[model samples]
Target: MTPSAIPGPIDPPARLLMGPGPISAYPSVLRAMSAPLVGQYDPYMTQLMGETQELYRGVWATSNDATLLVDGTSRAGIEAAIVSLVRPGDRVLVPVFGRFGHLLAEIAERAMAEVHTIETAWGQVFAPSAIEEAIVRVKPTLLALVQGDTSTTMNQPLDEIGAICERHGVLFYSDATASLGGNDFEADAWGLDAATAGLQKCLGGPSGSSPITLSERAVEVIRSRGRIEAGIREDGDASAADFVRSNYFDLGMILDYWGPRRLNHHTEATSMLYAARECARVLLLEGRDAVIERHRVSGAAMLAGVEGLGLTVFGDVAHKMNNVVAVEIPAGVPGDAARAALLEDFGIEIGTSFGPLHGRVWRIGTMGYNAREDAVLTTLAALEQVLRRFGASVPAGGGVDAAADVYRGAA
Candidate 1:
């Protein structure tokens, strides 16, 4: 473990990322991250932050002024929104459909909010009426949920859920970390109070930074707790809170860093901001619709391929996420062994399920830059070989042929 004992530099072997997140970064994004670094307060760096915000606003489909990047990963953005908005004793209602929903509940608990949950079976989404019933019963101050749960590869229906929150006067927040860039999301139209996402999964970038947007109401709630310094106060000025708890995750100060005032918070993560910017740039240049369409087609191909491999898909087929698929493990097949073989022999990575789905399903991702014909074909072909080796009765060339038909239809 000593320095001299350390081995020489090693290059990474190329592999297709077909897991939940931190998916393969695009070549352009990697190059952007490697560009020369600058001081935190450099004018060019500030401009980069501004442009990054603008880019995310378009991706989020919102015009909120409070859009900015959280320095850490996607979870940082989740904590920033929840801790900033939910005061102690505030009622926060979370809907538990998958593991990520439980994550929201856990974070809200850490923030000292009184948490309530509307529970649903994994791989299933709550109906609008079900959510409305819970909201009316609990009268929660805040409602937090995930747009897509990568653990189960299911996208929760949002349009009606947003409406229910609005009707009940509850603030709506969503974690779109798994769905953004690959699926359709409309923050403003969907009436989201706050939405946060990461660049790694579908945005074709690394996982160091998070993109977040706050609606007007979300801004107002955070502003109520804004801090004011003695030196900065004037005779007629309004005083603010003495200390905003959790300084590092404070969105108010983050807003200041992103706003016209341009105050310092943490030194902006230069490489991560550059990567996030490039991710957005790639999506924008491709046109948002085109990017979404690409995910749709690729996901369809993946679905057809998996089915053609003589495996059954889990969950309601219509409710699946656009970038990830869940397939049931065939009877008597060693799921773990198949996945390991896919990685070791074929240089492809797929995900295993969690919670109730443990040992029951294999999750495969078709996301970001990896959502292409070649990636899909490679994964399908590798999976067929592995399954056949494991004694599954997969027909020869069936998976590849089915996927080819899907691609042909798209063309």
Candidate 2:
């Protein structure tokens, strides 16, 4: 390849991301990413890091001092928390309801923990009694769960599960990547030992950084397994015999880097840090409850719109998340083709489901910056066109009108 063949600076076409995340980032978040770079230890950079931790405390509704940003995607946070908390051969219980639930079980297996799973149907969430019964049988050292799984648009109830784990003396962790910021999550009140989330969902930013918080108990476990790397080791520093296996995901070392110790780990991903900081700042400015309410309204509108178009909604509608809804594909409509047509002709994007729901349902999202009146109405209107074009019967102006009624009711 010739040097001249190099592509021009990235100039991608714009489209509304109405699928399950990596959704449209807030405009302010994009502007934050472009801020001039600063040294990792620059006073301003350190200040921003500390401030981000505090802001996330409000976001998580927790007083945990161990809260901070992980230098990778949302999955990175999940791995960091699990691997650091669960030692080799430790038992871990996971309750699977959808794709992400399986992801938690898989990560636990990779950590070499003896993983146990109890699953309900794809569209169903477990009752508190069911989780408690599993806890009694497994007696696991950790209970790993996903608060929201986009695959089925289902939100597992975490509020009661935490107390169940506490009674059984098990560490409770939740992957809130698809739920936090857009839903009600009380890390402290829910008795979560650890929780992690990504920015691309309801946080209104790109996917590079993850926000994570750890309870004091969770922090104690991670620190007990601490191992400072050789070159960075100082006179009195110590390492545990069963230290966390993955250096990159060792929460203890990461903590030293974020803590007042000012220790060096990896050179910070400065721009992503800026983006993370701004996402929290913006959410706090808008008021956390207010942002969640916006998501509730948008999700309800999307659900009504699809139903109004004569589409069937999937899952236990009573327990669906406030940000995404799964609409069953009509018998005659080609799901992928309709989605592609919507992308090409309307310049919008929605998602197809995975696993059992694959080819059976389309997952539509109203989240982050795209959770608005105009975005909901436009997507429904465009989708009506796409469905009709694909030879599916849809009510004329039905989707828009139903969605509008929802907004009016919300107002």
Candidate 3:
């Protein structure tokens, strides 16, 4: 294409994402991304990487030295941890509650692990004892879990599972992509061996960067099968008899690169590193507990507002995530049409369910930069309008008023 024919200065539409994830990045995060790049091994770049590691340590609530950023999206962190830890035929038990749980099990199977999955209804989480029983029966090498599955808008309680996993000698790993900053996750205190999260949800950034933390045990497992690239091999250097399956997703090599050794792997995603760093900075600045409380308040408003619109909340309300809600689609309203109108007509984006809940529920999120009173109220108000337009009866201004009541109580 000619220079003239090519599009000029890319401009994207202004959107307010009040959906499950990939919401608007915090202003500081975007500005950080726009900063000038530095060379991979440049002192400044490495320094920034080190700083980011420290900040993420706080985000994960861990003192583990393996805290670092994986270059791809949330799934990269997940795959890295699983592939590096699960040797062929190693038993892995996954307790499935929603789509992401099934996803974890799928990844484990592909990694050549003998995977066992115990499942519950989509909108419900398992009791810790049920998982402990499974661990005893399966005698698995690892327990892969999800902290929050946005598909069901449920955040599984991890506080007790970690202890149970510890008792049964199961390595505990959780994907916190949908609940990290806006929810409570104690990586060390909860006995989590490895925890991974993404930038797009509660972290208030884009989806490219994934922050991951590994405990001493988790690091030892990865280090055992560590492999050095052929180009970087030295005379005395050695690799494990069975090296990691995927070169790109290998956590051992990535660890060396992030550590003081500074061994070359892939060139760091520098701009994403900056954004991830700032996301942690801004999050910590607000105080983790305070940020969580904000999500709680805003999510409550969204729930109340939706109920006021005469909609049913899905699943177990007591265990729903603090950032997203799954409301059942009204009987007469077309779920897709309502979502489309919410986007095309109101410039607001909301999410629909996946798998079992598809076409039956709308997954609305109040997370990241969009976790605010106005964002919640606006989404609710707009949703009410769309449903009413689609021939569903909605009480006028009831949604807004109920949301106001929530805010008033929160204040």
Candidate 4:
């Protein structure tokens, strides 16, 4: 194929991503990615890496010394945490409530752990007692789960679950990929031994560079069995016979790269590092608590707006995530057709639900850079038009008016 046969230089469409994550990144975050590059171990590059690590410490609400960024998306952070800490034949327990919970179990299985799971219905979260019961029954070495699952738009409560894990002598880990920045996550206070998250969701960046943290205990588990990567292995130290399977996803090696020793791992993704740094910087500048509250209000507005359109909401509302809402697609409306019209005509994109809830609910997100009054109102207005056009009887201006009332009340 000739070069001209390929597409021209990428020109993506302008979109308001009122969906579940990879939402529009903050303009500044995108600009940060375009900054000039530096050599991997250049003093300034390492300085930026260290600064980025410290920034993530604040974002994760942890003081753990092993906090750092994983090179791939949020899933890489999760895989690293599991494969590094969960040895083959170790018993792992996962409390399942949504698709991401199942995802954790799948990853744990691939890591060769003996995985056990107790499930709750979709659109709901497991109670702390339920999780404790599973722990007692499974007596697992680690507990893997997700904090916010975009699939169900549910936020599992972790505070009591963490305490329960401690009582049962199990390591606690959660993928906070969809919840970290715009929702309340207290890694240290809530007793999370390991937490991994991505830049795409509430962090207001693209889907690369996973920020992760490990408690002293979680770090100890990894260090006890971990071998230095072959690339940086020295003559004196011996490599482990059962080292982690994937070198690139090895948190132990990645930590050495991010840690004070500055051991060479892979050449870091420089552009992603800059973007991750900027995402954390922007959120911290706004204040983490402030960001959570902003999402709460914005998400509530979106929820109320959807309700005003005479829509029923999916899920257990009390435990629903603050960054996304699941609206039940109206009975007569063509769900995907309405979605396509919203995208094509209004340049707005709302997500479809996953798994059991697929085609039953439309997931709308007011997350990351799009978590705002204007975004909520704009999406509601566009959604109302699409709903009406598709033969659903939506009240004219109902969505926007309800959202405006929410903003007024909030102010």
Candidate 5:
């Protein structure tokens, strides 16, 4: 256990990540993280930060001035949005379709809000009518939902839900961590008060930064709860018991840090800032619509290829995200063992299921840099061998051949 006895420098095996998330980052993102760091308040750093904010505005399809990155994972962004907007005793309605929906409710509860949730079957999503009924019944101040839940690979329909919230005079927020970039999301056109996403999914970056957008109404609510810290406040500054519960997650303070005022909150995460900036730059440079179409084609190919291998896909095909898919584990193939074989034998990594689907399905992802024709075909080929080795009957080259047909059709 001595230092000298340890292996030389850090090194990792090359892996083709076809999992639900934390996929292999784009080469440009990795390189961006290694760029030289500068002082937090350096002019160049501030300029870069401003540019990142603008770039994310385009990515989120919003005109909100509050669009920026949270210095943590996607969950941090979720917490920041919920805790800042919902005060203790405030009523919040959450429609639970999968694990992440439960997460939104939990974070709201932790912030001392009266959280109410309506549930649907895991493989399905809530109808617009169901959500409207909940909003009317709960009379909540906020309607929090997940746009995409990787656990079930279901994308909740937000297009109509936003209008439903608007009719009821409620704030609408969504966690698009797994759907953004690969899917079609319109923050402004859809009437979203707040939305958050992470870069690891379809943005082809690591998990440190979370991009968030807040409509003007959402900002006004957050502003009412703002309380400047003692260290930064001067005489005549105001404080109250109703200040945001967690200073670190207070969107008001974070906004001040990112805004033109340039107030010091926390030292900005410099390296992650570079990576996030590059991720948005790459997406915009390629054209957002073109990137989404690429994901659609790749996701379709993966779906067809799995069916070609005689495996059933979970969830309603119409509701699935264009990034990840869940396929039922063959009747007798040891699920975990099969996944391990894929990793060790072929240097590929697919995902395992959670909750109700555990041990029943394997989650395969075609997202970000991995959402390509070659990645889809390679994963299908490797997965076929693993299934056959595990005693599941798989036609030779069936998966890859079927996936190739999808690519050809797209061409």
Candidate 6:
């Protein structure tokens, strides 16, 4: 296809993104991404990286000096943490509750760890005792888990799990990609050795960069594996590992780039870093508690609205995630068709479930900048219209009314 044969500049239909992540980016974040690029070693660029690290520290609620951006998407952050932390033959325990749990196991396995999992039914979270039992049985060097699983719209309770890992002398790691900024997360207080998140979800930015934080324990593990290959170190210095294995994904080198010495690694993705910095800056200026409360209220409104539409929610309602909700697909209605209609006709986007729940549930998200009153109400109203068009018996205006009532009660 020749360039001239292709379509001309077209405006994307403005969408109300109520899907599972890559949520609508804030205007400031988008603007930041459009800023001019600079050479990687430019002093101003280096200062930008330092500022990004500090901003992420505030978002993550951590004082860990090793915090920085991983050059890929959120999963890159996940892989970097696992591959760097779990050495060959190390034991790692993962509590499987959704698709992302399996992801942690797969990454650990690739890292050559002896991976053990304590799995609960999909849409369910592990009890504190259950996790404690797993830790006792496995005696793992690390415990990896996800704070929120968008596939099931479930938020696993983390505070207790952290304590359990701590008691078992295990290092706890979490993927807070879908939960941070919109929900409660404490790195130091929760005893997390490492936690990685993405800018795309609750941070209101694009997916090119990942924000990661490492505790002292996590840092020690990385440092132990650091080695100056043949000519890289001083003569007679103790030899480290033959090589760090994965070069691009190595957090040790990434840390040095963020550290005072500012060693070389991959050329940082300047635009994405700017976007990440602005996202965190927006969150910090908004106040963490205030942002969390906004998500809570907006999510509550979405849940109430869906229930008022006479649709049953898919997960344990009490343990649902603050940024996303899973609603059962109405009988006789094609799930994909409903989602397409919502997008094409209403200019709204919602997600479907993954794995075993595929085609059985719709995942509606209230995340990042979209977690607002107007977004919630508009989504509910559009959903009602779509469902009614499909002959689903939804009470007219009931969903929006219920959502309004929820907001009023909260106010």
- lDDT against the true structure, per candidate, is 0.90, 0.94, 0.92, 0.90, 0.93, 0.90
TM-score preference between candidates 1 and 5, better one: 5
Which window of ten consecutive residues has the lowest lDDT sum in model 5?
A: 232-241
What TM-score does each of the candidates earn?
A: 0.96, 0.97, 0.97, 0.97, 0.97, 0.96
Candidate 3 on 59-121: residue-level lDDT in tens?
Answer: 889999999999999999999999999998899999999999989999999998999999999
RMSD of 5: 1.6
Task: For candidate 5, give the lDDT.
Answer: 0.93
Q: In candidate 5, residue 166 scores what lDDT?
A: 91
Alpha-carbon lDDT of model 2: 0.94
Steric collisions counted per model: 0, 0, 0, 0, 0, 0
Off by over 4 Å in 3: 231-241
Candidate 6 lDDT over 257-349, as tens digits, reads 789988887788888888998999999999998999999999999999999999999979888988999999999989999999999999999
Error of 2 at 201 (Å): 0.4
Worst 10 residues of 1 by lDDT: 234-243
Tell me how candidate 4 scores on lDDT.
0.90
Give stretches of model 1 more than 4 Å off.
Answer: 1-4, 226-244
After superposition on all CA atoms, what RMSD does each candidate show versus the true structure? 2.4, 1.8, 1.8, 1.9, 1.6, 2.0
lDDT of 2 at 298: 99
Of 1 and 4, the candidate ahead on TM-score is: 4
Candidate 5 is scored at a TM of 0.97
